[model samples]
Structure formats: C-alpha cells, structure tokens
Target chain A: MISDTAVESDTAVETQRGLVEIYSTTKSFHGNTVLKDVSVCVKPGSVTALIGPSGSGKSTLLRCINGLEPIDSGVLKVNGEHVGVVERSDGFYSLNRKKRALQRVSVGLVFQHFNLFDNFTALENVAIAPMQVLKRSKSEAYETARSYLDRVGMLERADHYPSQLSGGQQQRVAIARCLAMKPDVLLFDEPTSALDPELVGEVLDVIRKVSASGKTMVLSTHEIGFARQIADQVVFLDEGRVCEAGPVEQVLDNPREARTQKFLERVFG
Target chain B: MAQHPADLMESINKPRITRKTKTEKTAWIVLAVVAVLIVHTLISNPNFEWATVGRYFFGFPVLKGLLLTIILTIVSMALGTLIGLVLAVLKIMNITPITILVDLYLTFFRGTPILVQLIFWFNIAALFPDLFLGIPFTDIGWGINVNAIMTPLVAAVIGLSLNEGAYTAENIRGGFLSVGKGQLEAADSLGFSEWTKITRIIIPQSLPTIIPATGNRLIGMFKETTLVSVLGVADLLQSVQLIYSRNYETIPLLIVACLWYLIITLALSYPQKKIEDRYSKHKNSGGKVTATTEGVKLG
Candidate 1:
C-alpha cells in the first residue's frame, strides 16, 4: 500500500509539470559574486539562449539551474521542486550530495569541451548513468543508449573511444549521453565553441534537432546567428546580472537597454 | 658510347664526406671497442666459477631462498599498494587531521633508511614488550609477547611494506593530480556520486601515470628483498652466503646471486612493458585536452 502511494505521488509530480523559475538567485565564489539577483522564467518546451561576453556569468547561471553549482541566496525551482536546496518555515537548507544528485535527474548538462570519459566507449559512456543511477537493466540501458546515439548520428561510432573521435563526433556523443538520461530540461554550456570552424555546424545541427523536438533547453552560446535562429527567449547578461531578456528578436536586434545594444553591436557587427 | 667502365663511373658525381662526418664514424668505432672489451673481460674471467654457478643455480637451498624472495616481494608490494591507495585518497580528500597523520607516516618511513627500519622492527620488543588485543584504555584485555610473535621474516615484510607504502602513496597522489580538473567537473556535472567519480573516472584515467611508476617500484622492491639477508633470514643473498661459507667459494656464490637477480628482473620487464603499452594506447593521439580551467574570479 505504501509503495503504491509512493508510485502515485511520483506520477503526480510528473504530471504537474511547471516552468523552471529562478527567483532572485544570487551566487558567488569566494568573495566575488558570479550571479547577482538573477531571475528568469523559462516556460515548458521553450529554448532559451544565454548570450554575453566572456566572464558575463552565462555559464554560471546555466550551472546553477542544473544544481551543478549551488546558489548563495534565492530559490531555483524546476517543475515546482526546489533545486539544490529545501526551504522550511525558519530558513533554507542545502541538500545533501545524494539529494542533489536526485535533483539532477530533472536536468542534463552538456559541456563545451565535450568531457567524455576517455576510457569508455561512446555506448558505455551513455549507458553508465542509466545502469548505475537509474538501476536499469544492462540491456535496457544499452538499448536506450543506442537509440540516443542513433538520434545524434553517433551509432556508427558507438564502439569508439573519445580520443578516437573528432571534436564534432565527440560532442554529438556527449549530447547522446545527456539525452540517454531522459531528463526534463537540457542545459548546454557553449556547445559549439570548442569545435573547429568547419566542425561547428555538425554539433549545432544536432542541437537544432534537439531544439525542434521541444525539449526545454537553456544554452550559453557565442554564436549570435544560431542563437537568433533557435532561441525563443534571449537573455543578455552583463557583469553578473541579466541586462535584457525577452523575445529573441527584440533582445538580439533592437534592445532598449544601452548595455544590451552595445553588446549586440560588438558581437553582431 | 664505347668508353671504358672506369671512365664512365668517374663521369658520375660522388657525394663528399666532411671531417665532421669522419669523426662521427670514429666515435662509433671507439664506443663499439669499449663495449666489446667490457663484455670480453666479464665472460672470459675464469675465477667466476661458471661450473659451480651452474650446479648451484637450481640447488635446493638456493631455490628455496628464491621462492622466499618472490613471496616477500609479492606480499609486501600488495600490502604497500593497498595502504598507499588508501593514503592517497585520504590526502586528496583533505581531511585535516587524517592528512597530517598520513604526512607524518610518510615522513617517518620515507626519511629513514630501509635497513634501519628492518632492524627497528626486528627489535620492536624493546619499545613494546606486550601488545594488547582489546578495547583501548580498558582493564579487560589479553596481552601477548611481541618478541614471540615477531619472526625475522615477518619483521622484514613489515619493514619493507611500511617503507614502500610511503613512496607508493606519493606516486599515486601524483597520478591523481595528473588527471585534468575538467574530468572531475564533468563527472560532477553528470551527478555521479563521489565514490563513482573516483573509481570510474579518476582512477581509470590515472592508470597511465600510475602503472609505469608502479612497475619501477616493483623492480626496486624485488632487489630490496635481499636486504632481509641482514636479519639472518635465509633469502636469496643469505642462501648464497651460506653456501660460500661452507665451501669458501665467495666470489662464485656472489656471481650466482647476481645472475639470479638479473634473470628475475628481466622476466619482470616483459609484463611491465605490456601493461604500460596497453594503457598508453588510447592516450597517444588525443589533441589538447581542455585548457587549464580559469581560476574562479574573486573580488
């Protein structure tokens, strides 16, 4: 009876899908603030692109959403569940390691450098999290891993190690690794920035496929043109705060804020 | 068309050799002569007693001593590597008190001579005559004599294992340090548990760095086992000493010991090379890994 109730609550939580809401989130490293009072509402199935210059805290904000790094102050919620912290009547308490890992089930992060495990084949890389964390059967996980690899066009190179693959191929495998987990929201940190000029298109093409599939994705990117084409919402961050965020067209083309206009001129000019 | 063959050959140009090239050829000839002379002196020396060495090479006592040496090296290395792995992880974990404790252990064991440590362990009864096997600070306990339990062979194994653990810990720590920080961040971002991160990601990648150093240590440990002869334990060196003492053929027995050591080390080298090659195969071609991460900015 208790197990049945637990399953019911789990499904109930799944059904009540909510927007990813960041409420006045502040994050710092040592004495310096990387994200100061940053808040953004990402509706379900929307693709948001975070754009700014180097040290503009775009990556940090993406990291905060996935619970990879913690916020010093404020609540970050995904589908109405607090991320990385739990708030009580008295105060907020940080989640433990296991709880934080559980929170990560709702989100997946793809790194700019495609940090695939060097010793593992592309298939093993994708299958590991499912077998280890999700406790899925080996065959089941491998089947899911293979399907995701096929989706990313890495099925042919499934047995290749990361060192044996090109940067574009490795990044596609990395995307498959994230997709295999079946997370609700996907976060990409400069996914194509680390690729060679000719190779960038292959990775961006995969990301475009994922974007069109309507998965909630937040990507920090330097590619203004790609961002303009894909992102439903464009967030322009300067220093540690969000400068201007709205429809991608207005934020990227004609911005009201002087900082946003200046940044766009410098980047798109 | 009808010119003589010699005249035709002279018509074609010949490459010139400079004085520097002639000197380089002479240098190679001189090195070859020196190497051949050294080989000749060693092989042609009659006093080496090749007959006695061949007879005693597979002799019972010498074979027994060789077996003991092999066992000691294997056992001590296993113990040392296990302890070293634990110490390396503890140091990296940075638990202040435990890190300081491990530091003291490394300093004391690595700082002193291995021979001295062997002697110290052999006479450990002087420091603690009785060892209790019960709860600490409790009156209810059973005590046993330390001297009775500590044999010469046991003392040697303990000494070698403790000393090797200190060096192995540093090697392992260096291995872990050689792994890029981006690897750790990627594992963390994937939400792998700390245990999974270390076992799956960190240790596997650290193998290329760790395996070669470990192979060197294994070879050193094999030779270092001879130090146990100082304790009157009948290891390879001591067995040779016993045979020479009985027959007064000291140099021959010494030659026998050297030959055995050479054979064992040569045997070990093959597998070591195979292991190194296996781990390094995947690492040779990867382009620049992620650039050294930018330090987190501080106000």
Candidate 2:
C-alpha cells in the first residue's frame, strides 16, 4: 500500500537541522576496499569539499553517503534514518526501495556525467522526482521545476532536451533537478570534471551560487580555486583515508600531514 | 536514364555498369524470361483450370480460418508479451530463489522446441494425474491442481506464452542492459524509486532498443500461431486442412492459407516499419546491420 506520509516524513526529517551524521562507514567493491573506516559529518548549513587525486576514494565516499553504493560496514544516519547497512557482517536488512528513495530525497546527488534523462525535456526531467516519486501533482511539480531552473538561470532552456544543450547547460539542469527535490544536503561526485574546459566555468558558477544561497553541499572536485573560494572545510582524501580535514584556509595554507603538503605542492607549487 | 550496356562501355572506361544501364539490362532479361514461360505454358496446357482457382480464392472455409488464425495470433502474442515482461523483471531482481526459478523457466522454455512443449502440455494429464505445487514431502498450502482445468485452448495459450516469454525476456533484458547504468544511478539520485526509474527514465530511453526486437517477436508470434493446428484448435491452417483433405487439391488449399498469412503479415509489417523508423531516429548510423533491417549484407 502506498502511504501519503512518505513526503511529509521526509520533509519533517529534512526540516530539523544538525540531523545528518555518519559513523565508522567503510565500503568495498569486488573484495577490494575503497573507503576504509570512514566517518564524516555534514552540519545543517555548511559546505564541505572532498579534495583528492586519482583513485583516492573520494567518489566512493560520496556514493556511500547516499546508499547508492553498498558499504561493507558502517552506521550512516541521515536525518536519524540508518542507511547503507544495519549490521556489519549480516549486511543491510531494511534496505528497501522506499528507504533508499527516502535517503535520496534527503541527500540529492549529482554525478560526473550530467546523467539527465535525455528522453525528457529539461522541464520534464526536473519535474520527474517531485511528481512521480514524491507524489506531487503535475502543476505543483512544474512550478517548482520552473523555480529551480530559474535558480540555475536555466529557465530559458527548460523546453530543450539534455542532448540539445551544451555541457554546462546540462549540468546546470542537473543541479536544478536536485534543487527541485529540496534536499537538505547535495552531494556532487566530481560534477564539473566531465565538462569541457570552456564549459567548466558556467557549471562552477552555478555551484558557487548554490553555496552562496546557504545550501549544504559536499562536493568532490579538482577545481582548486573553486574549493578555495566556496568551501568552508576541505577534507583531503588519500588512498581511502582522510589525510587532512580542517578549515579551508588551514588545510590549504598550512597542512599538518606530510602527504597533504605533498598534494598541495603538486596542486599549487 | 536510357543508357544501354553496349553503348555505355564506349562512353567511359568504367568497368562497373552505370546505375540506369544495369537496371535496364536486368529489366529486359526478366521480361524476356517471363514472356517465354507464359507462351510455353499457354501452348502446352489449354485447360489450366482457372475456374477452380477462382472458386478456391473465394472459398468460405478459407476465409473463416484466416480470421481465426489472425485472432489466435493477436491474442496469444499480447498474452505472451505481458507474461514475458513480468518474468523478465523477476529474473533480473536479487531475490535468491526467485531469480533461480526464473532462470530455470527461461532455460526449459528456450531450450525445448515449441512443438514439443505444446505436445507435452496437451499430454500433461498423463504425467501429473493429480496436479499440485507443494513441497515433495510436506503437504503445504502452496499448490494448484492440474487435472480438471487445463483446457485445450488454455494449454495452447500456456505453450505459446511460455515459449515466447523466454525470448521476450532476452529481448527486454538486452534492451535494459543497453541503456547505460549511469542513467539508473542518475534516476536513483533524483529520488526516483525503482519502479519510477523503470517507467520514467529507463523504459523511455530503452524504447529505441526494445521496440525493434518486440516488433520482430510480434511477427514471429504471428507465424507461430500456425503451430496450434496440431492441437485441433480449428485455427486457419486446420480449417483449410479440413477442407483440402476432402477435395484432394493440396496446392489450392495451401495457396488460400498462404495468401491470407501474407496479407496479415504485410498489414502488421507496415505499422512495425513505421514504429522502427520512429524509434530509430537516434540510432548510430555509422555501423552496419544485417540485411533483415534497413541495411545491406554484401555476402
């Protein structure tokens, strides 16, 4: 039976602040450990950037947060709801579509490729979650989609399909799609890394605006300058572990970890 | 446009025949052969039985059987497609025993011949005198009986639908697999549930891949209906077989069924082609397909 309270519970959980927390999260794929014994927290109104090099497990960390990738062991809680796992060896017991979708709404995610549904126009793509999954009426979803598109300055391109738009336009539409769901925390897994060099600025600009609007965002990005500008805290990941995590200025300016020093030198030497 | 092969060899030293010249030469050759056959047949056989041909062409049994064949084909295909979709989804899921059970179904249906399966279903009363679906030792409440209700039409539907289900599952699975995993992940992150992911994003995008296979299956199913004549179901082929066994005119009776099948096939194929053309708008045209599709095979 479908319940009318799913959206209402989700909204209530999201409305309460300082509720998202992760404790001792660890993940592996094909018996190879990717994120090992990871623990992180996102405050209600803070921007945290996960910065690292190739194969540093930054993307894995982000995916674990959303339960898209299963974690081998962990107790990750988003808005007081457990995700990814209930027990270490036994695995997740209550991992149903309902709970997974509920977690997705609370923590909206964007991928490296702007994986917008190419079959739908931008407006339909934006309206999808609200109307279909969240059970909002069509008109209500469309109005919200319009507002989010306007927020990303993509209102003009709402009628175009993802294939018809440029790389930056598609990414912005993806952002608008996340926004339409009104997630408490937005997770980006190298969102701008897939864009062309010329198109990068347009997408980073939208993220910058979202950050300025006080949306709590956790991003894994190689854009050093954007991180310096927008991030409140930057966590440096190296070989499936958090090497250095602190104030953006402290980590960028004075790294206590030798590996962080080496990474910063490689990025900004 | 009017270039002849003998004259064309003199104009340009191109060894390959010009398009118009080749067409004209082929046309003349075909016309000459047809004319010779017509003259020879006319001269040899004066009484060719044109009246018999006319009577069989407008025969009542043939017409009625054609309609019955079409109805069976439509009903069976529609039923098969629906059951196949459910089985395909069940096969793809992570539930341990269900996936295994669905795989077993695919294997048995796909590996066995359709005619054998039909015959086996028809002869089911002998094998399982008492129908039940419970554990071997435990008399549980999880079974249904087989003796009383497995009617001939029911058995035919069961046979056709089960056989087609296996092939449809493969087609649907292929279509689902062709859509990138990123699309599902993206829909996942968008807060779309599993069902929503399928109905909204995956299915719509996969339409381009699934529709062609589905149309092909529909055509195959249409012909597979003739296999039901073995069950004595009075479908088109059986109806014609009934009449021709008496008259002893095998060719004319076969011709009547053949013409009806051809007409139905052509009618269905027009819409199938239109659908193929519609969904094929985004297909990668740089590569080649077999001659069965809108492509050519050199060998």
- CA deviation > 4 Å runs, candidate 2: A1-24, A87-94, A256-258, A265-269, B1-51, B126-154, B285-299
Judged by whole-model lDDT over C-alpha atoms, candidate 2 comes out at 0.79
Quality class of the docking in candidate 1, CAPRI style: acceptable
Put down candidate 2 lDDT per residue, B146-251, tens digits, no spaces. 6566776777888998898888888887777877788888888766776777666655666677778899888888889888889887878888889879987766
TM-score of chain A of each: 0.94, 0.90
lDDT of each: 0.87, 0.79
| lDDT tens per residue, model 2, A79-172 | 6667643444755676667767776787888889988876677888888888887889888889999999998989998877676788889999
| Candidate 1 ranges with C-alpha deviation above 4 Å | A1-18, A30-32, A88-92, B1-55, B134-144, B277-281, B287-299
- Model 1 gets an lDDT of 0.87
TM-score per candidate: 0.86, 0.81
| Model 2 CA lDDT for position B243 | 82
Q: Which has the greatest lDDT?
A: 1
TM-score of chain A of 1: 0.94
Residue-level lDDT for A188 in candidate 1: 95
